[model samples]
Target: MRSRLHSPTVRLRRLAAELRRHREANGWSVSETAGRLGWRSPKVSKIENGESRRLSADDLDKLLNLYGVEERGEREALHRLAKEATVQGWWANYRDAFGSRALPDFETEASAIRTYEALVVPGLLQTPEYAEAVFKGAGLTDDAVSIRRLVQARMERQHILFRPPAPHLWAVIDEAALRRVIGGREVMRDQLQHLVNMAGHHNVDLQVLPFSSGSHPALSGDFTLLEFQDPLDQSIVYVDTASDVRFLEKPDEIERYSLIFGRLQGHALSAAESPVYIRDIMAGLESDDRE
Candidate 1:
């Protein structure tokens, strides 16, 4: 997870998004760009959309020339940005791991995040000790120093959830997660208490699905729908399995995730009552701990 957040290649995607804006404003079709570049239309579309893995400086020069960028300084900056873009797909190496890469980008631009978590409190809601304990339980073994560093990174990531320009976060947790002692009794109690504390914030809306809700949509794995303020920009779906993390794009797939989130939200406790519901779970956990 720490490895995923330290990537620099992700910066280039921001540059790519900028170039796309200029192309749209100029009303250049993919075929027109293809004609100017002496390449196929698909190539132009892929680079403009930040989907090109082997982007080159020469290709960037040709594309910018087609856009009639007369200023030398502006052109140079874009050239450097393109050169930097050639770096490895920041998230590529970790493609088989978790989807931590998407969170930074999402934190930068997402206006709202609707998450359906089936088995635990979201990472953003984890206490430092809870994060450390959960990582250990997940088999993230390390000496004292490595464990501290990893936990610190996870803690830093949580700042995005409470930053000044924070996005609206709607997290739906299942009852089973509330019941599970992820990091033993004490850590689980701390984690649940943290959830109750975060629920006090207006920007954060936390809801829990009780057992009685039974057999609703989203019995599947965990997923999150990230919506941006710019409607022209497409939304993203973050899906996590125990082994792999997938960032999805297809419109229909995103819609399915969104629809499922809507249904789960209905089954969850209301915003005002969510803390109350979770506190009850915490009390139950505390009682069991005493026994």
Candidate 2:
């Protein structure tokens, strides 16, 4: 589970899932839970969907009991999981300092990540200079030291690429991201090389939507579609904007995003051509005196 390795979000998701299962077992609609528990219909959803503003251990206990799971040991195990799940991970420390949100997931288990980025190099593959330049453009410039630390943190998170039980990552980037000279030519060169190196990894599928491709579904905006291992269960669409992040999980919403991604794949170059594309960009960057 992603929560096991990244954040407490996993446990919260399980809590919601457990509640849902019990409600189904008892043959109760969400309205039934609301009626009996003196909650509004949305409250039932908040708790069962794990979108509650706060995690109440007492509430979880009540739901568990209402579900009629008689085993004390099982209840305790889930309770403990919920408690841990409520705790913050390392990224939480950066909340006030960074204000960057939704870097990880808490619910809707996603076994694979399909990412599309256009303007800048995605955090997973940024060189330090490129990272700083991209952030500076966003007005995140504060202390150079803090900026460097943040960059290091992002690089560390890249370990996920090689971790055990790794998620299959399909990263589709645009040619403009490569052609754009971020942090001057030097940083762009290093960035291109990193892309080449990362593409060699078996777990990663890197493809470039070359500028030659006239238009594609992902052209409107960039979003990631995360697919879980299970069926009709955990899946989400993550869309990041300058000021807010949105997570979409409805079946229709996910289907639309999936279709968009499928169309993008059809227009983009294959993974096998990724390295060649990178090298071509690198050569162009090197010729510039600024590099």
Candidate 3:
């Protein structure tokens, strides 16, 4: 389980990384920097590690001054980031449904999202009925109210798709996911239709990896790679397992996944053909319904 304390917002993470970079470039150890500021070592460590409960403007200014960051524009930008870090996003209201996970926070900041789904439709593309079915199928909770809340939260997450300057969503879904049939034929049909519809969105690119493609790189599991507009805000890969969720930020990890996704795209049907492919599957489902 992700600890609530350590799940800093994306802005906070960027701020922390910047501060750490400045300290390193100045060739000052954490203890030495803390000593220079007359502050405890842990305080410096926490701020650099993105574990601070809250970062004050005063503290940020002090750190910038020590680093000799005299450029007014740069200082003002960092100050804006510090202020933005403290503002709670709409996701905060849904904490009960999402726990302390920062996936939504990161998603909110992402400028482009590349995702590969092997089991089911990506959450951002799931319909309300399909989402409800998924939550219930996972046995995440027995309470009907909780399931409803989760479904609502999932739907709300999709709002980013429609917002102006929407992040581009490039999704490669496995054929197995399309054929799995969740929430009965009617629901699954609707879900497939939703995918086809979403593919038509200007910012969304959808592809289907048929089973016949066989022996692919991401045969292991699903992962989402989020890229931010700001260069300082590094890209991250999100992996969710039955037991836990992991965020990968290392350059090597990102590169490996990027390669895997590129391969997956190569194996999958192209954007132009994918919706047609889904419609074919939907035709089979309709045939099944009529039978």
Candidate 4:
């Protein structure tokens, strides 16, 4: 059990996994470890399973001591991670705008992001007008203030694209996304042009899943696979549905999503050819505007 809603949430899970690993390495069961620390047995399980969000440095130090971790460097690293796990990220400020799982926080820590969008442009690449339209169409709420907050939060999430050590983002967008005019034709025109510009970036790989590729992998829906550089921290697959957001970390699930994403990349246009394909679409949209 894990709460991977935010960056700190993921960090917390990693910390818990580490503690559990160390405890088992030293031949300490949860009950035995809790007895040594003078705590209830369930408390140890809570800490190791990431059910406890109140993980503190002092608590971590005690666990390390009980586990007989003599290495100072290892101790300091775990301590730092513990601190980070509890710290609130920028997205925390917009709690009302987000659902249970914090997508922005996960994006911030991911080293590479692979996404497949079947209907609309991915959030990271959406323009303000396009984003506003998407939100307005969702019928989430009628409150204008709440809508603005959600849009702003999305725009803020895009900042990671320009930050130092930006993550490699590979997005496979369906051709239908281009034809579906959200926020009117002008808004979509600008959005398509934006895609062309973003594709030129070294870290951005944009591909169009052309209509010609029928019955391909990922026909069920859209999903994102996030990869981390650290071996200790495993990759994750995120799926957003009408009801809720799901985070998949089990090895088999991750492998399944990875395979699906791989097949998607195979079916989509090559990154090098995506820009021209987009430009041609833009031309078609322009021609339609004249007629």
In the range 1-291, model 2's lDDT, one tens digit per residue, is: 223363466566666787788899999999998888777889889877778736677877777778788898988877876776766666565464435444554322356888899987777777777888776666766777777777766665566667776777898899888898877777778888998998998878999999899878887788888776645246778888877888887889989998888888889999998889889888877766655
Off by over 4 Å in 3: 1-8
- Name the best candidate (by TM-score): 4
Candidate number achieving the greatest lDDT relative to the actual structure? 3
Task: Write one digit per residue (lDDT tens) for candidate 1, span 1-291.
Answer: 223222233445556676787787789877886886789988878777677756677777776777877899988877766665554433343332324454554544567888887877787788988878767777756566667766776676576677666778899999898888887888888888889989888889998888999998998778888777655557888877767667887989988888889999898889888889888888998788679
Candidate 4 segments exceeding 4 Å error: 1-6
- Given candidate 3, what's the lDDT at residue 164? 68
- The segments of candidate 2 whose C-alpha lies over 4 angstroms from its true place after superposition are 1-6, 34-43, 53-58, 71-77, 97-100, 106-110, 230-233, 289-291
Model 1: residue 110 alpha-carbon error in angstroms: 1.9
Candidate lDDT (C-alpha), each: 0.74, 0.76, 0.89, 0.88
Choose 1 or 4, whichever is better by TM-score. Answer: 4
Local error of candidate 3 at residue 42 (angstroms): 2.7
**Mind sharing the TM-score for model 1?**
0.77
lDDT accuracy of residue 13 in candidate 3: 82
Q: Write the per-residue lDDT of candidate 4 for residues 1-291, one digit (tens) a residue.
A: 222234787787788889999999998899999999999999899998888888777778889998888899988888877877777888878788876568887888788999999999999999999999999999988788888999999998898889877889999999998889899989999999999999999999999999999889888999999997667678889999998889898999999999999999999999998889999998998999899
TM-score of each: 0.77, 0.86, 0.93, 0.94
lDDT of 1 at 174: 90
User: Clashes per prediction?
Assistant: 0, 1, 0, 1
